[model samples]
Structures are given as C-alpha cells and as structure tokens.
Target: MTTRTDLLVVGAGPYAYAAAAYARDRGIDTHVVGIPMAFWRDQMPADMYLRSGPDWHLDANGEHTFEAFFEDRGLDPGEHDPISIGVFLDHTEWFAQRKGLAPDPRLVVDLTRPNGTFVATMADGDAIEADRVVAAPGVGYFAQRPDWHDQLPAARCTHTSDLVSFDDLAGARVAVIGGRQSAYEWAALLCDHGAERVDVVHRHDVPEFAKVSWTFVDEYVDQTLAHRGWWRHLPAEERAAIGRRFWEVGRLTLEHWLVPRLTPGVVHRHPGCAVTEAGSEGASIGLALTDGTGLEVDHVVLACGYRPDLARVPYLAGVLDRVAVTDGFPDLTEGFETTLDGLYVIGFAATRDFGPFYGFTKGCPSAARIVVDEMLR
Candidate 1:
C-alpha cells in the first residue's frame, strides 16, 4: 500500500522533528520517517557530553524549548551546563510528544520524484508519496576519510562515527587523527575506557580548552530568516570574517571540562603534524608523521569530521542528478529548498547556503519556520 502525505519528512532528528511539527501545525499533513536521534544514540559515545547548552532545542514555535523542558521537569539549567547526549535525547522525545509528533521510525531506502510527485521507498518495501519532501540527513554519511585510510588493514581502522564504544580498545594503543573537538573528546573517552595509550596527531596546533559564547550566532540566524539570500549576499570579506569567527570559537576552543578526562601521559598530543605515511606492521599500524616522528598503534580512529556530498547519500542515488551541488553541498535557495522543486535539505548539509548555525540545533526553530513558510508560499 502507498502511504500519502502532503509533506514527507525523511528524517527524525532535530531538523526533521521541527520541520514536521511546524508543517503539521499549519495543516500540511506531514509524515516523518527515520529513527529518532539515531545518530546521537549510535554514533556518539555512550557517555558523551554535548558542546551545546540546554538553550538549544527543536521547537519551531519556541513554546517548548529546552529551557521549557528544564522548567517543566524542575531541572535546574545551571546543573547541566554541558548537556549530555542522554538528556538531550530525552528532551527531544518530550518535545515530540508535546507537539503530537510520532515519527514512523522507518528508514528511507530510496527517494525519487516521478510524474510530479515525490515517492520514497522505505527499508521494509513500503512506499510513501508526498507533494513535497524535506530531508534532514545527519552528518554520519559525510564522514571525511583521510588519504591513508585504505593503506592499513581495515580491521585496524575505524571512523569516530563507528567507534562509539571504547570497551574493546581498553588494552589497545590507539592513534586518533584530526584536531577538532571530536578528536580530543574521543581521546578523553578512550582514556576513560582504559585505553593503554592514545596518540592524538593533528596538522594544526592544539586547541585551547575554555568557555566561549555562542550568542553571536543569533544575529546571523535572524538575518537568514528576515532577509532572503542573506548569507550568500554578504560581501566576500564579510563572509570570510564570519567564517573566521566561527573557526575561532567552534574549532579553536574546546570545552574546559574535557581537560581532566585527557590524562597527561596516557593521552599524548602531537600537534603541528600529519600522517605522511601509514601501513600495517604485523600486529599494529606504523605511522610516519610530517614532523619526522613515528608511532605504532593497535588501531586508528579518523575524527577528520564530515564534508557534505549529496551523491554520497545512499537514498538520493536515484534522483541525485536532479539536485545541483556546490563542492559537495546542495545549492539551496534562501528557504532551504534544493534545485529540485518542492524538495528541501536541512541540517549540516544546509550550512553552505544558510551559514554555520544551520549545522547546529540553535538554527532548528528558524529553519523550520523558514522552510515551512516557503512551502506554504
């Protein structure tokens, strides 16, 4: 049987939930599909902490914000400064219930538009037809693999996304690549899991652990909603300046809370370095660094982060040609619609056109409002 909906949301993360809630509230008959918060539950470490605070949430109307969740549950916001993944997931469930949004929990195996209507094939062979489709894919599909990924035996290599639990690595020596927050956080988690030794190698200087403010992103998100093509219309230098500001706060600064978890001698930091060469060496992987250093580890974790590529999305393979892409990101309109009519892409993939804030939960409410309003128009 074919399920029909006016608006089909192809994910159940923060972006999908918000968009669906908003669309339904506007009488769009929205139907959502995907495991709710699957990426956060499976890809992230079991005991991981989020860099974002309780203020970030997925309520498009802003009536049931995370702050509201805290108040309703009588949980003090200060007690959860750096929120845990578990708590955030609970809040998402509460928000969904309050909005009467229950995702189908089925994966969209394939997506294509035929005869002026969108058809989505579910993993269980069900088909859903809709007038419009809003896909809010998470970042797991876009994980960036380094050049040396294939050099070593596959058993000794893993991406951070797939290495959520470190129990198996308790007695192993591991090497983590990338200088970003994930790299450092994973290192700390590995230490907590009893990894004998962890070597963190990166091409950039080690980032400082300090508290930083994200209030600066509010203005940009507001501008994105108030003015069409706001981010793309900015002057070249202005865009560059904004990018720099984000890099400084989001990348150059890590949460001071991670400092204690990264034990001194157990987790070594090799900054200003790159893996020039890597190969299997009997029981371990041998790595040659750009700084003329060498290391041997039982396993390697690639925390190089994600770069959105529409073609890499498995479900979009059938209709990918219909979508225009810049670099790897979709060429979206100011309202987050892709080149394909009535189709929208949100979350991390929308960052290129909407600005970096769209890649975080902070942009959820605004993005939901913008996309739904555009759909109505």
Candidate 2:
C-alpha cells in the first residue's frame, strides 16, 4: 500500500509528536510514522521518574501543559508523587488525540530519497511518500558503547537503555557504569531488584548534578541557537571543536544530583579511572580499569552516553553526503532544516544547530514552530 502526504515525520517520541501537532495546527497534511512513545515506554525504566519533574511539561502549546492535562483527565497533578512514567505516557496520548494529531503507528523500516520526495517503507509492508521529511526519531539508536567494551560479549555488557527487566539480574553482582542521572537511577533499580551488589564506576572522582540554573541554561540556549550557521560555514574540524567547547561549558556535570544518592560503601566509587577492557567469563564479566585494577561482575550496565549515527537512519543514508553532521550530530539550520532541502531533524540530533536546549522538553515547542512555519509556508 502507498500513501502520500505533505510532510513525513519519523519517530513518535516527544519531538516528533510536537512537530506533528504544530504542523496540524498550521493546516499541513502531515503524516507521522513510528512506534507510539517507544523511547519513553520501552527504553526508560518503569520505576524511574522524570528528573526534571512533572512541572516541566512537554506541551508545545500552552493548552496541553501537564496541569491542563491533569485537570482534563480528572486528576490532580500536585497530588501525584514522582510523576509516574505510565501517567506521562497517558498524558502524551491524550494530548496527541486532543490536537487531532494521531498518525498511523507504524515502524519506518527504511527511508530513501527518491527524486524530490522521500520514500518511507514500513515494517508492515506499506510505502508512503511526502514532499518533506523530518527525522524526529528518539534517542535509542545512538547508544554509546565505549571501544573497550568490544572485548566483552553482548550477554555480559548492555546499555542502560536496553534493560528490559531488572528481575533478570536477581542475586547477581552488577557494575553500573557512568555517573549521570541514568546511572544512579539504574543502580537504584538494580539494588531494589535484589542484586547482590551494584558498583557505579566513573571517570571522575565524584558524580555531578546537572547545573539547573535558569539564567545559565538560558544563555547556553541562546548561544547554541545563534550559531546555527557554524556547521555550514566552518570546516568539519572547526565545527567539532565548537561542539566540544559547548559540551564542556554548557552541559551539566555528574556531581549535581547523582553524588548524594551514593550510600558511601554500597555504591563503590572509582573516580578518575576509566574502563580499559571488558571480557566475559561464563556468566560473569571482568572489567580492567585504567588505574591498573580489575573488577569481576555478572553484568555491566553502561550509562556512558549517546551519539547519533546517520547510517542507522535508513532514509538519511541516501543523502548522507549532502547532510552535514558535526561531532556526530546533525547540523541543522535555525529552523531545524538540514542542508538538504525539505529534510529537517530535531531533538538531540539537531542540538548543534538549534542550541544546548534542543534536547530538553523546553526546546521542542520552538523547534516545532520553526519547522511548521518553514514547511507550511
């Protein structure tokens, strides 16, 4: 089967949904395809709560704020404790429906640029075409596995985003790598699930919390958005240098929140040490540290970080040479449009182009507005 639309959006996560909502409001014949809330529902741990809190809503328009959604659903946002993942998903679904932005829930298996339109092939044996395409796929494809991990078998090492069930590690010794929010949250979950022991390893001496100052964050956002043309005008080397600078200066360090949760001895801290190698031994794994030390464990959960791989994006490969990526991130225009005309990428992938706030919930509305205006005009 084949269908056509004015715009094709890949991914149904927060960014994709917001883009679709904006397009709908502007009277664009937009069609989005992807698993509904796949990242939030599948990747994130069920027990984990949004670190940003429920007050930080994902609503693009003010009408669909968390407070409003709660009221419309006959629930009190204030009364809810921790703001469960299930509740957030429910609210997203409700908001999507309320805005008349329900797109067919289909996984886009392949994307190809054919002539002037984009050809999207779905897993269910259907094809769709659109004048413009926006790859708003969520963050899972870019799971960052350190090079040292190649020594270990897949069975012993896994990214935190791949954890399907904590029960699988019952009574086992586990090493939760990294010192970010996800790392701490995964450790907490492992301990709660009866793991024999959970050790959190970090390259730094202590975990850091994300700097949440509104003024500082706002300045970072402005600087990032202001340099949208940096990728286009500068050489790849220069662009990468800028990305590293921004990452060092603007990104929140690990000590901000994760350090307080460490129960002195329970969560073993190995600061200033890096994982040199990883290998599996039957059901257990061995990790060689940079400080000439080794630790044996049954499982290793990597919360190291993420990077966008354009090759995984099926449709993007055809125009891969045309779309410039800086520091493994898509280089988008101020309006979230890529170098290739009619192709836009938002969310984390577009951070280098949009600014530091691109990945946060707050940036989604502005990104949606930018794309909607460009495509609907």
Candidate 3:
C-alpha cells in the first residue's frame, strides 16, 4: 500500500521523535516510520544507566522533559540520580504516546528516489511517498568489525551490539576491546552475568574521555555554537572531519564512573594493548595482541565503536552517493540537507553538519528546531 505525506521522518529514536514532534506542532503532515526506541530498547542492556546525569533527560519539547514524563507517571526524576535504561524507555514510550508520534514499529527496508518525491518501502511491504524525507534511522546496527576478528570463526566473535543474551557467555573468559562507555558497560555486564573473567583491552595507558560539564556545553567550548555557519560554506568532506573531531572531543568515557564499581579481578584492564589476531581453537578463541601478548578466551566482544555504513541505510545509499561522504558517513549541509534536494539526515549522521553534540539527548531540541524551521519555510 502507498501512503503520502508532507514529510516522512525515518527512525524513532530521540532525534526522529523530536523532528516528528516539531513538524506535527507546525501542522506538517509528518509520518514517522521505524521501530520506536529500538536502540535503547534492544541494543542497550537493561541494567545499564545513562551516562549523563538526571538533568540531561530527553526533552525535545520543554513541556515533555524527562522530569515531566516521570512526574506525570507519579514518579520523581530526582529520586534517580542516574536514570536506568528502563526509566528512560518508559519516558520515551510515554512521550511518544503523548505527542501522538508513536511510530508503527517496523524496519524501513528500502528508500528510492522517485520523480519528485521519495519512495520509502517498509519491511512489511508497505510504501509511502513524501515531499521531503528525513533520514534519522538512528545508527545502523553493524558494529565496526576489527581487523583481527577476521581470522576468528564467526560464532566465537561478536560485537557487543549484536548480543541480546548473556547466556552464551556463561563460564566463558571474554575479552572486550575499546575504552568507551559501551565497552565498559559490556565488561561490567559480563562480569555480573557470571563470566569467568572479562578483559577490557584498550590502546591507551588508561581509558579516558573528555570531561563532562554543563559549562563545556555552553557556546565557548562547543565550537558548534560559535560556528554554526561553518558547515554551510565548507566542502562536505571538510565538514564531516570537523564533526568527528567535535564528537570525540565531547564524549566522556565510562571508565570515569565504572572503574570504581568493578569487582576485584572480575574485570581486568589491559591498557596500551591492541588486538592483532583472532582465531578459534575448538570452543575457545585465541586472540593475539600487537604488544606480543596472547590470550585464549571463550568469546570476544568488540565494543570498538560504530561506523556510519550507508549500506545498512538502503534508502539513503543512492542519495548518499550523490552527496559527499567521508568514511561511509553522509556529508550534510548546515541545514542537514544532503546534495539530494529533499533528503536530510539528523542525529549522529548529521554530526558533520550540526556539530559533535548532534547525537546527544541535549542536541535533539536544537536540531528539531532547525529542521522544523527549514521544512516549514
């Protein structure tokens, strides 16, 4: 079946919801397609808490702030200093329903450019056309597969993003690579779930990330605020390069908080080491490091990070090719528009154009304001 609308907002994450809400407020007939809260619901572990503090609740509309959601539900946000994933999900579900922007939970299978509109095909054989298309489908699910992992059999190696259950790692000695929040959370979760030992390997002497402070979020430190016009004049490649720098510069590693809570000897840290080879030995996996070290583990979890692969976002692939892309990520303009006329990207994908904070909960409101203004005008 084919339906049509003024704007088709793909993805149902914080970014997607924000865009849809803004558009709806302006009386734009916007249709949001994709699984609602898929990342927070599926990828993130239930036990994990948000890295940001309570004040950083998801608030696209000021009235629908995280605190407000909890308050409406007879809960108190102040009671939870660090909100759990479950609470965040509850807030998102409530917000989505309240705003009447809850998406029909389904994967967008393909997107193709028609004569003057975009033809979006869904997994269930539904189709829609829109005057403008917003590609906000969160991050693609594929984790960055490390080079060392190619030698290992598929079953023995898996990215942390792929795991839905810890039952497979029972009594296993697992090694997780990277020093970001995901890596630390995966290590903690594995140890909590009965893994024999979980080794967190990092290339740095210690896991470190930029300090998180509300002051840094202000205009002076976050260059995006100072140079909002920079993206429009620069070439796409240059813009993306600048965006990546901002993203890396703003993130705070989980080691800052998780290190103190680690159980003695359950989670080991291997600093200044890198995985160089991975192979399977019967039920175990053999991993070799660049530092002339080797370990035999039952499983390997790669938390290395994510790559913005256009292949997973089939709808934007052709449109993406027309625009400039750096390292497989879309190159967007200051307004988040691609080279394609009616196509725009938001959230992490728009970081290059919007700056480093584009993917965070805080950035959603500003991005929504920008996109809604552009679409309406």
Candidate 4:
C-alpha cells in the first residue's frame, strides 16, 4: 500500500524530531519514521552522561529546551552540570510528545526516485510517496570499523556503537581502542559495570584536550548560513581540520568527568601504542602492540567512532549513485539540500557542508530552520 506526505523524515532522533516539528508547524505534511532515540536508548551505556551542556536540546521552534524539560519535571536543570543519559532520554521523549511527533516505528528499507517524487519502501512493504525527504539516520550509519580490525577474533573485538549493555561483561578484562571520547567513555563505563580491568590503547603519545569556546560552535553555524559559497570554497582537509580541532575539545574535556571512575588501579590507559596484531589467546583475546608488548583481554572494544562517508547509509544505496559528493560526504547546498531537489540530509551526513554544529543537538534548531526555509522556498 502507498501513502503520501509533503515531507518524509527518515530518522527519529534530535534532527528528525526538530525538522518534522518545524515543517509540520509550517503546514507541511510531515511523516517521521525510525524509533525515537534508538541510538541513545539501545546502543549507548545505560549510565553515560551527555558530553554537552544543558542548552543542547531537540527543540523545533526553540520554545522547548533541556532546561525547560527539567523545569517541567520539577527539577532545576542547573543543579545538574552534565545531564545523565537516562535524564536526556526522558527529555527527548517529553520533547517529542510536546511536538506531537510519533515517528513510524519501522525502518525505511529502500528509497528510490523511480518517478518524479520519492518513494520510501518500509520494512513491512508499505510505501510513502513524498514531495521532499529529510534523511537523518544519525551516526550509527557511519561507524568506522577499521580494516585492520579483522585481525582480531570477531567475538573479541566489537565496535562501541554495537555495545548495548555491559551487564554480562562483569569481572571480564577489556581493552578499548582509540584515543578519543568513545574509547575513554566506554573504558569508564566498563569500569563502572564491574569489568575487572579496562585498558585504553591509542596511537597518540600525549592525548590533548585544548579548550574551545562554545561561541565558536555558534560561529560555525552562523558563518555557514551567512556565506555558504565561501564556506564550500574551503578545502575539505582544512574544514575537517577545523572541525576536528573543535571536536577534540569536547571529547577530551568530557574525559575529565570520567576520571573519578577511571583511576590508577581501576583503569589503565596506554598511550602511543597501536594494536599491531591480535588472535585468540587460549580462551581470551591476545594483542601484539606497536610498543612491542603483548596484552591479553577477555574482549576488545573499538571506539574509533564514525566517518561521514555517504556509502555507510544503507537506505540511500538505491539513490547514492546519483548524488554529488565532496570528499566522501554528501555535497549540500546553502540550504542543506542535497543535489536532488526536495531532498535533504540534516544530521551527521550534513556536518561537512553545514560545519561542526549539525552533528550535535545544539545545531538542531538552526539546521531545521535552514531546511524548512528551503522547503518553503
């Protein structure tokens, strides 16, 4: 069977909720799909805290904020410096409810433009024809499992994105790979979950977490909106370097919060080292490191994070061949619209073009405003 809407929002996270709410309020018939906050609720550690501050929220018209959510729930949000994961999930659900957003709890298996309009085929064979589509599958689509990872036993090494819960891993020693937020965050969580030991292995000799101002984040979004031609003219490497610099501050600064749980005895971090080789060690995972030392662990977790490669988006497989790309990311216009008319990418997929803001909750309102303005145009 087939249905129709003016807009199809493919993911139900912060980006999709904000986009659909704004579009719908503007009188656009918007249909949202995918489970709400699926990534945070399912994949992230149960007790993980948000790396961002209280201002980060999924408000469509900027009327609702995490502060507002907390106020309504009879709590002073200011009391909690960094919100807990569970509290963030509650806030997201409350925001969705307030926006009247009930995303179709099914996956869009395939999307194609066989005719003039776009058709989204659902997992259950239902179809939705739309004049426009907003794709925001979040970071899960862009997870980076390195090629060298295959050297380790599949059961031994797992991507951080795939980790649902550490309940069963109690008392098991684990090694978390990477130097950034995910690696450090997971190492702390594993420790909290009663893991016997958690070792962080990274290639950098000294992990740096230079301070970056929040004003810089706002500047990125504002500058992109003000002068996109100049923004796009910048080389991809230069843009990535700036974004990486901004991103480093968040991850590294956030790591300080985990230090209480990650101490000298509870957690050990090995810097300037890379896993050169790996195999099964009797009944455990064995790793040969670049430091010329061997280590054994019950399991290994790769917190390498995601790359903005469009190839990682599964539902877009049917349509990817036609869109123009800039350095493996979707090439977007000033309005966040893809090469295809009436179609847009708002989340991580739009980061490279829209700047660093689009990848975080704080950028949702700006991103939604840009896309809605374009769709109205």
The root-mean-square deviation over C-alpha atoms between each candidate and the true structure, in angstroms, is: 1.0, 3.7, 3.3, 2.2
Please estimate how well model 4 matches the true structure, expressed as its whole-model Cα lDDT.
0.81
Top candidate, metric lDDT: 1
- For 99-201, candidate 3 gives per-residue lDDT tens digits of 8886977777778886878888888898888999888866644368777788887777878777757877878899988877788778878877789898888
The residue pairs found clashing in candidate 2 are 111-315, 207-254, 207-255, 208-254, 208-255, 208-256, 209-254, 209-255, 209-256, 209-257
Q: How far is 16's C-alpha from truth in model 2 (Å)?
A: 0.4
State which candidate, 1 or 4, has the greater lDDT. Answer: 1
Off by over 4 Å in 1: none
**Model 4 Cα lDDT, one tens digit per residue, 1-377:** 99999899999888888888888889998999999889888888787777676677776566878878887999876667567888888888998888888889989999998887999999999999998899987898788886778877787789998885887789998988887877877887887789998888888754654333565676666666567444577888878787677756765544456667775686877888988877785778888888887878999899897888887788999889778888778888888888877779888888766666677888887788788988888
Candidate no. 2 TM-score: 0.86
The window of 10 residues in a row where model 3 has the poorest summed lDDT is 217-226
Q: Give each model a TM-score.
A: 0.98, 0.86, 0.89, 0.93
Model 4 bad stretches (over 4 Å): 206-213, 228-230, 233-241
> Where is model 2 more than 4 Å wrong at Cα?
208-265
Return the candidate ranking by lDDT, descending.
1, 4, 2, 3
Model 2: lDDT equals 0.74
lDDT tens readout by residue for model 1, 1-377: 79999999988889999999999888899999999889988888879888988877888887999999999999987888789888898899999999999999989899989899999999999999999999998998899999879998887799999998888999899999988899999999999999999999998899999999988988998898889889999998999999999999999899899999998889998999999999996898999999899999999999899999888889988789999998999999888999999999999999988888888999999999999999988
Residue 247, candidate 1: C-alpha displacement in angstroms:
0.7
